[model samples]
Target chain A: MKKIALGLLQVAGLTVFSLLVNTLTSLLHIPLPGSIIGMILLFLLLESGVIRLNWVEVGASWLLAELLLFFIPSAIGVMKYSKLLEADGLQVLAVVLVGTFAVMAGSGVLTGAIYRIKERRSS
Target chain B: MITGLLFLGLTIAVYLLAKRIYASSGKMYTSPLIITPLLIIAFLLMTGSSYESYNAGGKWLSDLLQPATIAFAIPLHKNFKVLKKHAAEIAAGVLSGTVIAVISSMLLAKWLHLSGDLATSLVPRSVTTPIAMSISQSIGGVPSITAVFVILTGVLGTMMGPSVLRLFRIDNEIARGVSLGTAAHGTGTSKAFELSSLTGTISSIAMILTALFSIGLAPALIAVFLH
Candidate 1:
């Protein structure tokens, strides 16, 4: 009972912290992403030793581990416009496949090349 | 009612398949992000249910994205020192890559004579979801289309990023993370985590930077190029 209660408390605490930070960012009209603001707040708390890592680790890990699952529904939103996809299905596929490959290759090459140059200079 | 059960069952099945594939390949091609979408599509085909019904339950799951995104901070905190060291180079690399990606895609779409909406949809192709969606909206693109593009970009980056890096022999963790995050967003960041903590941390930073840069630049670029 105690462990279960503690676990629940941890989850609630993290959720509240996340919500509070998100709210603060929105209210302040911060240009940064709200979730990012929440993250920074959490990081600050952790760094200051105000919130021990162990205390939040269990809850945060559970949430992060299932992170991809969280996007599943949003991905399904693709279905809402099934007719659109079916009509331009090939176009969508071509764009998604080709565009994705291009972005990955282009960014990967650029980032890798820049890092290599920096390494040579530093070393 | 029965649809809900079927959706749950399919989600479990895909989760299992993803686990099996990951165990063998240890690659993002087999990630849950890719697997789940494929599974959902398969289920839709097999059951003959429209996407609306499947989304009825699935939407609840996606609501967690906000919290999940915030959870990225933990990993970012762990990687601060590495980022601090290569801060300038990292910033320049990701910023340039992101700008190039947005510009090239928009230019290509215009050259191809694609509709304005299609061109707009392609604008936020490099950043993470929230920022991409917002950019798409401001630029008059369909947010849903941009979200789909963003996810596809992330999955592809996770799958092909390593090979591309190897082709260029770019082995630095910071570089790997920045490239992955810049191109693929959260999914790419997830792949970075598998490589190393430093890679994961840098990828998150790269993801954040790419989003900020793209969001600010996409509107201005659209005005210059499209208007």
Candidate 2:
């Protein structure tokens, strides 16, 4: 029960943090979403030692692990576009799959190459 | 209020059941995210229930996405020290990955003669759900379609990333994580976490940096090709 309360409190903290970030982003008229801004804010808070990592780790991990729940509504909204799907679903899925692999390959190769170069230069 | 509660309970129950089947069944297509929504979508169709009613419940649940996205900083912070050591090299790798993902999606859509809105929506398909959804919004893409695309990309990335990495002869854990995270976001990050905490940390960082870079890049591309 205490653990549940702690988890709830930790999530509450995250909500407060995200709300503040959203407000700040709106006030500053930043193009970025407030959630992304809140991510940065929390990072800075952790780095600055203002917030200990363990305090929120459990709740945060649970939320991230179940993150897809947040997107299900948006995904279900796809029901509204059956005509488009009947016409283009295969092409869209093909592009997304190909693009996903291309990205994984590109980033992996580049990071490995850079690390190798850095290692050689150092030695 | 009762209807709202009913819809909410149904959605969660379907989601939990999907997870159970996925875990016990060892089936690939039964991912909770994919299957649960499919089930709900189908159920709605059968019952002639309104999307508005379903969303009435889901919108409130999805509001947690904001907090979830922010709370991501916890894992990120836990893994920061490791990331700081190779920050520059990793950043460049992630930037290149994000560029390839965005550019390729745009080009593929163009090759297929997709519309401007269709092409634009595909641009942010590789980022995490929340950021991808929002980026799609800012770029005048359909967020629902873009969310579907993002989740699809993530699922494919998690499934295929390791094999693709091997094909490229890239074996570094940091590279693996960075690539997956940059390419796939939360789904990829989850796969990385399964590998090791260090890799997961790097993936988380890559996911954030990729979103940051994409947010800045998508609009310029939108101006050039979308409108």
Candidate 3:
């Protein structure tokens, strides 16, 4: 029970921190999203030792573990745009399929080549 | 209020069940990520329920994505050592991947003669949903459409990423992670974790850096291609 309580408290802290960062982003008219900025700030806080890993680990891990749950609704939002999908679904599908494949292949091959070069130089 | 609660309950029930099925099956096609959304989509369609009603409850869940994005810092911090050693390789891979993604998306959308909004939306589809949605909105594309594209890209990546990596002879874990994360974003990261934790960690970093680069580069790249 105590562990659960601490976990919830930690998550609450994270939520508050995320909100504050978001508020600042809007106020400053930063082009980036609040979440991105918040993430960077949180990382810096952890690295600088201002925030301990244990402080956020449980809640962060839980959230990360269930990350897909958060995205489902938004993806379901595509149902609302049936008109667009029906009109250009084939074209859209083609672009995404080809684009994703290109990125995966391109990044994978390049990184492999570089990794081999770096390993050879070091050895 | 009851309707909203009902939809939320329904979504959670389906998601839990989907997770269970995926766990038992251990197949990419059976993944909770794909099954949950597809099941929910089918349910909504069969019931003739409007997206707004479903989203009335669904939005509460989706709202957490921002916080979830912030939660990524933990893994990043935990894996600092590995990240440092492979920093040069990871950075180069992510940067090149971003450039290739943007250029290919633009050229494909143009060659296919998609509208300006659609071409714009396609540009950020390589990143995570939250980042892609915002980037789409900022650049005058439909955020919702961009979200779909992002999710589809992720699903495709999760399903086919291994084959793509194998075909490219990418045996290095870092290379494999970078490919999945840079191309497929969050879903790819999920798939990466299934392969190995180290790959997952690298994928997480790749996903974050990909988002940052896409945010910085997408607007300008879109401007050049579209205008």
Candidate 4:
């Protein structure tokens, strides 16, 4: 009972932090996601030693461990509009797939190039 | 109501099977994100279960994504030292990559004759959902459509990014992480985490940076190119 209560408390703490940041972002119109804002806030707290890692580590780890699972439902949210997408789906996929490759390729090559330049200059 | 609970149970059962297959096969070709969703989709097809019914359970689980995203900061915090070391280079790389992505998507939309709204929506699909949605709405695009495109881009990028990077011989964790996150956002970050914890942390930072940059860039882009 104590274990469950402690776990719930930790999760509640993290959730409260997340909601607080979410609210702030909306109020401020920050153009960034509330979750990312929440993340930055957590990072600041950790950095300042205001919030120890152990305080939220367990809850955070559990959430991250199954992060992909949470995305599935949202991903599959595609199916709700399956009919409208049926004709244009291939076109859409083509654009998206090509775009993905371009993005990855561009980022990877640029980062690698920068790394090499930095390495060569240092050496 | 029972459908929601039953659907959730079914998902867990299917996930285990998918996990076993993924492990046994050495995680080649199929990802849990891809394969498990395919299985559930197929099951829905066979069972004639509506997406809304499945979403009844799915939505509750998906709610966890908000906190999960916030929790991503833990990894970023742990890797702050390395982040500080390479901050400038990381920024340059992510900045160029996002520009390249936005440009390529715009060019592609033109070449394909995508409608005005569609083109506007597709431009920010490289970023994660929230940022992409915000950008889409601000630019006179359908946020829902942008979400679909963003999710699809992420799934495809995570599925093929590693091999594609291998073609360029870009094997460094920093490169991989930054590229994956910049290109595919959260989905790619999950794949990066699969590669290494350090890489995942870097990906989180890269993902956040790319979203922030795209926010500023999206307006100028549409004004200059689309108009």
Residue A82 shift from truth in candidate 4, angstroms: 1.8
Q: Which 10-residue window of candidate 4 chain A scores lowest in summed lDDT?
A: A2-11
TM-score for all predictions?
Answer: 0.88, 0.88, 0.93, 0.94
Model 3 bad stretches (over 4 Å)? B137-140, B223-227
Question: Which DockQ-derived CAPRI band holds candidate 2?
Answer: medium
The better-scoring model by DockQ among 1 and 3 is 3
Candidate 1 residues B111-221, lDDT tens each?
A: 666677977897897787878888888889998888877776666667777787787666878777877788788877777877887887888888888887887788887
Candidate 2 error regions (>4 Å): A116-123, B25-27, B133-144, B162-171, B219-227
C-alpha lDDT (0 to 100) for residue B70 of candidate 3: 88
Pairs that clash in candidate 1: none
Candidate 4 predicts chain B with a TM-score of 0.95
State which candidate, 2 or 4, has the greater DockQ: 4
Measured with C-alpha atoms, the lDDT of residue B187 in candidate 3 is: 80
Best by lDDT: 3
C-alpha lDDT values of all predictions: 0.74, 0.82, 0.87, 0.83
| Model 3: per-residue Cα lDDT over B142-198, one tens digit each | 887888899889888888887888788888889999999999998888778777778
True contacts kept of 3: 0.81
Deviation from native of the Cα of residue A65 in model 2, angstroms: 2.8
- How much is the lDDT of residue B182 in candidate 3? 98
Give the proportion of true interface contacts each model preserves, from 0 to 1: 0.51, 0.79, 0.81, 0.73
Model 2 chain B: ten consecutive residues of lowest lDDT = B218-227
Candidate scoring better on DockQ of 1 and 4: 4
